[model samples]
Target: MKRRHFLISGAAGAALSMARPSWAMAGAPAYLTAASKEGNSTWLVGLTEQGDVVFELPIPSRGHAAAAHPFRAEAVAFARRPGRFAVVLDCATGKEIARLDSPEGRHFYGHGAFTADGKLLLTTENAYDVPDGRLGIWDAEDGYNRIGELPSGGIGPHEMIRLADGSFAVANGGMQTHPDYDRAVLNIPSMKPNLTYLDAQGLIVDQVEPPADMRLNSIRHIAADDTGRVVIALQWQGNPLTAVPLMASHRRGEALAFFDHPETVRLKQYAGSIAISSDGAEIAVTGPKGGHVLFFDGATGAPINGRALPEASGVAQFGDRFAITLAGGLLEGGASGGKMLDVAGGYSWDNHLVSIRRV
Candidate 1:
């Protein structure tokens, strides 16, 4: 089957307007950025507190994910093309400030974060056909220059998080695909997935792999706590299709333990996007295939609560509230399909950022 084109065009703009609700008329823009899968563009949909889109700004590429600088108002977005780099957009003007590309032809695997002082930008890159990936370091303050690339230590380098201690923790999902976007003859057999730790200079400081029994569980996204404890979300790749869900943690060169999701077999198709609360009190993981966002007590890995969303993809934590992006019901299904559902009061089908505050 031909892969679906994920871009929104000028013609669909009118239909998108019709999908807007009356509630979109009032309030402050609650969302900062929205990734429009159908448009293959990231929209700066200005929103109000009342969950309305005030205005819209189109980004340059088909951005899968974005990271807002911790201190500055700028953000960096990643595209899927190998050897392709990220684009820096001015949040205030919605203009492209810089285009950061990789020299090694390694496409960024959709993840990036700004350093504490806002001087450094860290991102992940993976070769579509190669065994190993790379960690890219860039100078954020100076035109987003490529400083160097670090060994990602695994197959598919998906996401990375900066720890409080200044080290970096990366979740390297072990799977190789065709650089030309060809799925035929692409899926490799018995790929080994692992987690790697590195310092600011990109040297491998530590690493961890899955147990022999669960080698196919690819560690993809990750979130870290104040104490250097890293929580990894796993995506399954192997067969049998009926196996336990493996979620694990790593800290100080020791693997604490791994917790299995109660509904492992049922959650096999879910892509894991993990987030830790700002206070380090709660850890949340979104399973889009399972239609649920599962939360657990940070310290014990015990289940706390889980909420159902149409198709949750991204999860983030503000001060005391948790925010998530609900894409359309189907992962690859386009907007015209009946599978897409309208959000209660916010945006639709396209990626929307919504926050729920704790009472």
Candidate 2:
């Protein structure tokens, strides 16, 4: 169980130079990211729209999510939250391109996004010393160099989505933590999570938080459509028996609207991931702890469908349908049909399926 860290070797350098023009030779995966585990080893996986693995590159540890280069056959797999390493892979050649190491006193939150132009990489980070959330900017053309940073407008920022207008919508989870405590929530009772919208330059354009009584809901995952409508998946830190909505939708200049689900469709107060359909008409959120996936009408904030699945975790948009993965390695769809494909090699899909749609 030796740890693997990919550096920029000569072969990897060659792969990087030809990555853009020859990506089709790399299988041209439609949905780029989802991590899989095989015993003690983990890999950053790329899949076709039909859920076939196109490329699998070994990573240092478990990856929570990945950020795909908009047009190149490159991807960055981020380590689990509070983990400091993110490996950049040359998917076209199945080679490790480079690694991003968070600066001391700072750690990644297991998610990132590439600017639409593919020139910059933005990763959600925790400046743990100040206990503040940050967006670490990287120079994509310059070996993924750490270029600058921006305030995330809250405490613990997790997943982020890039809007069509070149801004970003960040789910600031708001619970403070440090490596010393190892994921322990230091401020749950006082935690105040918000969805903060920022421009390309990282200035807060707008932000929204839950109403007074719903403050304990932690905004952890986020999804957005082309029209700028954003959906959020929340993890409740309050009493598990308390009935509360686990998903919400919002647009700029409008109040946050939480989707209502039947009591029978209990989300167990946790939503691991959220995704919106291509047409922006439907939304899906997964509650792995509750063993269910729930869909909602994107515009009206109404629950459309719910299904029970064992260990349902990562979810993403697959054309007009939704692709979901369970902890047992089942890749399936919802509403339209079921069971796209199953991953082999003792690999189980991890949290957060990211779609690598063309920019």
Q: Lowest lDDT 10-mer window, candidate 2?
A: 1-10
Model 1 lDDT, full chain set: 0.60
Q: How many clashes in each candidate?
A: 16, 0
RMSD of 2: 5.9
Compare the candidates by lDDT and give the number of the best one. Answer: 2
What ranges in model 2 sit over 4 Å off?
Answer: 1-19, 22-25, 34-38, 263-265, 327-332
Tens-digit lDDT string for candidate 2 (1-359): 11011111101233554445434555666654546554678777776776567778877777898887766777888999878999887766667889999998899999988776677788999999898999888777779888677788999999987889877899999899999999999998689999999876567889999997788889999888888888888888888778888888888999888877873246788888998878777788888887888877766878787888777788887667688877555555664457747665566667777765454
Q: Assess the local accuracy of residue 62 in candidate 2 as a C-alpha lDDT between 0 and 100.
A: 76
Residue 72 lDDT in model 1? 48
The positional error of residue 183 in candidate 2, measured at the CA in angstroms, is 0.9
